[model samples]
Target chain A: MSIDAIHPDWVAVDWGTTHVRVWLMSHDGRVLDHRRSDQGMGRLDQDQFEPVLTDLLAGVPPSQSLPVLICGMAGSRQGWTEAPYVATPCSPPGIGQATRARCKTWDVRILPGVKQASPADVMRGEETQIAGVLLEEPTFSGVLCLPGTHNKWVRIVKGRIVSFQTFMTGELFALLEGQSVLRHSVATRGWDADAFDIGVSQGLDQPHALAGALFSLRAESLLNDLSGTAARARLSGLLIGAELAATRPLWRDHKVAVLGGNDVAQSYEAALAAQGAVLHALDIDTPTLSGLRAAYAHLKETT
Target chain B: MSIDAIHPDWVAVDWGTTHVRVWLMSHDGRVLDHRRSDQGMGRLDQDQFEPVLTDLLAGVPPSQSLPVLICGMAGSRQGWTEAPYVATPCSPPGIGQATRARCKTWDVRILPGVKQASPADVMRGEETQIAGVLLEEPTFSGVLCLPGTHNKWVRIVKGRIVSFQTFMTGELFALLEGQSVLRHSVATRGWDADAFDIGVSQGLDQPHALAGALFSLRAESLLNDLSGTAARARLSGLLIGAELAATRPLWRDHKVAVLGGNDVAQSYEAALAAQGAVLHALDIDTPTLSGLRAAYAHLKETT
Candidate 1:
């Protein structure tokens, strides 16, 4: 079949739980304009999603009638219709099924997330972002980490996602510092590098001793009168230790690319660097848009 | 000063978050009477603590009241007043300040929890339980595993709590199966021994490979058509694997006494047995009560 070159009105939509972003693109897929909203799929009920999308794209010209591709939690079971998960060890722009948005005039298709059997992990929109990364850097082979509430570490083998793992590091931190008894003992200060480094070292040195290490935060405060900042460091060490232990196998010989915000990615980079692993960082936002666009392009080619 | 031996009525209280238990006893520390109420210190405002205690012990003759000993979360800063933490490498039933509970008519003292400095770990009621175990079996030396929301594996030497560690295994299992994406893929069937054994073996073997193994559950289902039960098993394996990695250091050489409910304790026993460690099971509920009573007896003799 001869590929039909279609001029897409909007480049892509990276609609996640906490944020929604849309890109306006030219015929060749250059981003001409962009818009973002905090009305993430996570915050809205299923029925309210269509109107919100319409409201966000109200200014776009109707005559352009561009194909809009969506990805992220917008395709989750709780979001729009559940987009089937594509099996792993598959190429970027892995085959994704299209679901029509509940709007008549807007033709929208959500990209499917990817699932892997070995290591038993799954990713939603991040898979598409990974696809974008693969699209941009086809020769790169190693580990790609997307840090968030449920941090994902994906293995890329020659542009294919072979396997992946998810760590609830961010969520666990939030739960411990915000909800558990440890909250009262810890200070609400920002990150501390000395503490972070101490944590990372301890994490790597005594990964199996995490539970005991966690209690040490309280002990340090009571015995040596360790400051709350130090307590925070101890907590960080416990969490990072668990993460390191969980991710060590996947990262044994591979170089690593971190895809997330600067702060989160930086901590992971430091941890990996300490372990003598080569590291790279990609802007999470751009790759997400690129991935969405890639999926849109794939859809346009097929239908 | 010579130790005073008083034949006063002894009161033992186990004050936790959701419930408060009190035992009125003879001078020999035999339970003459017992009482329980929903007025745990966790539920009451700081100011209401004295009044609630007064209400709970309204009928007890003030003259017969001896020193009241308390344990558990009541000593947390948010509970009553922060009972100071006792540092490690100390004697059995480590030295801690006896803080007065918020009641005037009764002379109340709360037990301080044990703390470690190097790894920053602490535990409150477990120390007292260790004390009770020591009091009961003075020559007993082994790893005492207390499994719960935050499982504790404590080391005992003679009658004192020498060192200890904690695990968030239970909490992690709950979060993964109940809250995370794995929830959709797992089955709620009872324990699967083969799956459990697989998890234990994998956990002990590759403590560091846990995160990657977790993603494989979903991948295996997609690529190999695994059953929901098998998916659940894989998830269990990932968690158990991480836990084993975190806890391997403590269980490496020490003889282990699994202290918890039947199922939880049994699971740990089986896991440890697979690793060729000597394991014993102890009823968690009885030891806690026995420990409280022992504390009461000590208070009666020393006051």
Candidate 2:
């Protein structure tokens, strides 16, 4: 809590669509102070990005003109500055590809995102997270499944991102369970492992019956009084199962790492485990922060 | 225009969730005067049904106490009158099964819906549509593909709905286009036949790639300057192709009737036709009206 003791070396920011998290770092690679605001890249106009960051940093007075390393959607086209994506079959982008943002108060650099050319895939902030993963296990070569609104599955070999694909599974689940007609049938909060497992099984087994499977949830609720909790779990299972149906086979025998500790992430863990996948998992913030820190260190070394 | 010349014997109404469509019928099965309103079953309270119908019929005064035969969501449990579902492998319900709603001005009959036991499927308004199809072809023994918000695929054997499945394709399309992230990429209007065909081909050929396929639309738009019009059409094609993947196998060679002339229905027709389906198309209102008239006549003959 002693702000005077923290003459921070630099700052790390994960300025995504919904939130902007700032972390003041000490010279010893430790987080001296961390704060976040709802003023994400989504909330700010092109001109407001610098001011927003300035306001977000007013509390933690970093004595020196520190380098402000930003990641996530802040590098997107609609973001504060367009950090052009570095294509696949390459290592996670470092400061070499980081795009500089014009700011009066600080040296700001936004990390570049990764993109796949053929299947047309792109990820902005997740690239930093991948860089963080590589920091922990530099030679970690396999697949990384990052579950979120737009779930990303990346393939890595010899510390380089080979190819990746994005699935709107999380967003689809939210829309279907909360906004769609199935909203009437699904519970807001509850879990049933059996129901989820059954759903996953159905999703894996029935490739041509997704529409019917979705309708069946409503129908079962109507006909046999299927509980809302079960329906919710079942809905989750169905989506994850379908996602696995798309991605699991190629990596069934490979080492997979699922990120985060949320219920959705756990659901994926269980699903992948159900499908005979030995998953290596990580906590939520470790990778993003690590990636940012790694980027800062790499920048210093290269300079 | 001539409400005076039309002495209606009965009234037929398709009061679905969103709109109330009323047809004034003569004793000889002529649609003398027809009217409709936005006061659908979804908007009305249990008590409001009578008044809504009364308001919808205020202009066209049928001379006598008309036997109002209503179908669609008006028969749902949440609707005006709860006309419970009749299990599959039976002809569409008639007066014997129609639940009479307590109305002072009219003898109101809400027809029962059809339900499947195994896969757990139900249809309210769509059953009436199916019955209407049967009215046109009494000995119909094929699959009926009714494309709508919840698209219904019914298997008809000896004029009975033996089995049926419902898909949320239309609803999903609406959500993905208007509400989801892909909304940024998808055009509200325009068509590209080539894009649609390619999407359809992908949906049919690649069973394990829906999520990637969907995300590709946005990525392509961002990375490859994929046009919005083509994206919209491609979106439609992908959904229809997936639906076809689920259904086309069983009923590919079966005599198929695609009802309605909406762009979505036409897309389905094109997709089905692409998959070698020689489709039998029908104008929208005929089958529904015929189904109601046939029900009325059957009610009279049985009485």
Candidate 3:
């Protein structure tokens, strides 16, 4: 169809702290148009969300009250509408639990996040992604290793989130590479697979020595002229491997679905594969879109 | 003696990254006068160090070619004089190995630091402290735990530094407490010894689970309304405990001399005590001053 020929049935949004993405979906799940903005929930106050969303959608030709489905931090307490979290051992909240955000022209539904009570943990946008994963294989039971700023290893059995854990590995890598003293030694851009592998081994085998290991990067830089690229790669590997060491129970003997196709995910996949994890890679987009679709279907059925 | 009645026989200066301290020493090792400024090596360029020192010593009546003994990062490659480091398994660099800076009036001698070639570790200012510790007990042999921005664990055997390791524990704690997401949950002030003890135990016992443990602090704050003070204490304990876990060989089954009277050193002392470490707390100023005295004595003998 020509760009101007078709109208969107519903809008799927992946809203987060720093950015927001919108996909204009047709009735059959085709993406008619895609849009994005830096005006994420983190940047907007409560009242500013609707206006920002409305402005971003201004290019869309008028259609009869489009249904807008939003997931992620936008449903947080600081978001447009607070969609309370659903405790774990429960399915990712579907349309029935979706909260409504008041809008002048569209019926907006926001998916709730998931929360664990003891040893407390929470997930927002990823819950939608989880629902999307469930959409494709409702009967699938395995662990999902979602790699991001705060990497989450979620255990799933027969479609409900049994439990999950988060590791600050990605954030640590960012801080160490960009802010810590190691910044001088670690390059901003480069790849060193061998160095990465060594780092992973060190981190996994001698996890206790992380604090000392970090200082060694700077020491090596000063004493042995360690290349910045190698230091950077090693930093990444160290953090990821440390995370894997901590989260070993989640994926050690289980078949795992590695989410996303990003560099971080690939690194996680490699590290996991090195550990003899039976793994499969999934497109990062598949679960989010499908999750939104699943929510949309639920919204239609319940209403 | 009155301030104006006594003239310094020599000057001892400990210059570090963020601050510089100067002490006018009498012929018999008495501190005639003392001064400090934030104009540390990290803040000044090669040329600025002399000017800053000159300005600070304006109050001291200039005598004929006064000898100045300097230590710390001021001898770094970026400092006033590039005093090369002495490799380990040797005594802390004394005045015999001091480097001279081309200052106008003062005979400025900057003592060299110590370096470990194999593990790639180095210490600048703390070496002066080590020299001072050795000055008091010349034949003492044990481990010295120097806590600061970068905590160092040094093994001294019969007046020589056998080997040492640096842990980014203090730096990591600062970053996590002040800059990381956990900052939102941790308080800037408050104390909870019990919480700290628990964190230390957890960190030591499950050293590999540190990444997950850190995230749990934030989660606990959000879900359980965990107190900020407790979280802060726990965070400190966890980082220190992790460092202890890594450097167990340095302190375990060996007598450890815990340097510094500050909170950081005390924290390390307490954590080490919990690990059944044989520790003796020394006044923070003792080693630095003693080390400077020892170097000053050597300078007199040489020059």
Q: Report iRMS values in order.
A: 3.5, 1.1, 0.9
Give candidate 2's TM-score. 0.94
For candidate 3, the TM-score of chain A alone versus the native chain A is 0.94
Candidate 2 contains a number of clashing pairs equal to 0
Each candidate structure's count of clashing pairs: 26, 0, 2
Best by DockQ: 3
Weakest 10 consecutive residues of candidate 2 chain A by summed lDDT: A1-10
Q: 2 or 3, which is superior by TM-score?
A: 2
lDDT by residue (A16-111, candidate 3, tens digit) is 978999998987788978889999887899989877887767667655378889999999877898999999999888888888887776778888
| Model 2 ranges with Cα > 4 A deviation | A1-7, A61-64, A281-285, B1-7, B60-64, B281-285
Model 3's CAPRI class? medium
**Model 1 Cα shift for residue B43 (angstroms):** 4.0
Interface root mean square deviation for model 2, in Å?
1.1
Regions of candidate 1 where Cα sits further than 4 Å from its true position: A1-8, A26-33, A43-45, A60-65, A94-97, A230-252, A280-285, A296-303, B1-8, B28-34, B37-41, B58-66, B94-97, B174-190, B212-252, B281-285
Clashes of 3: 2
Model 3 lDDT per residue over B24-86, tens place: 888789998888999988788898887788776765666537889999999988789899989
Query: What level of docking quality does candidate 1 show?
Result: acceptable
Model 3 score (lDDT):
0.86
User: Model 2 over residues B1-303: C-alpha lDDT tens digits?
Assistant: 532444578899998888889998888997878899998776788999988888767655543357899989988888887999999888877668889898888889999998888989888877777778777778888788888889988888889888889999888899999989899899998999999998888888775577678999999999999999999988888887788888866567688877777777788788888888878766546667778887899888986
Q: What is residue B2's positional error in candidate 1, in angstroms?
A: 44
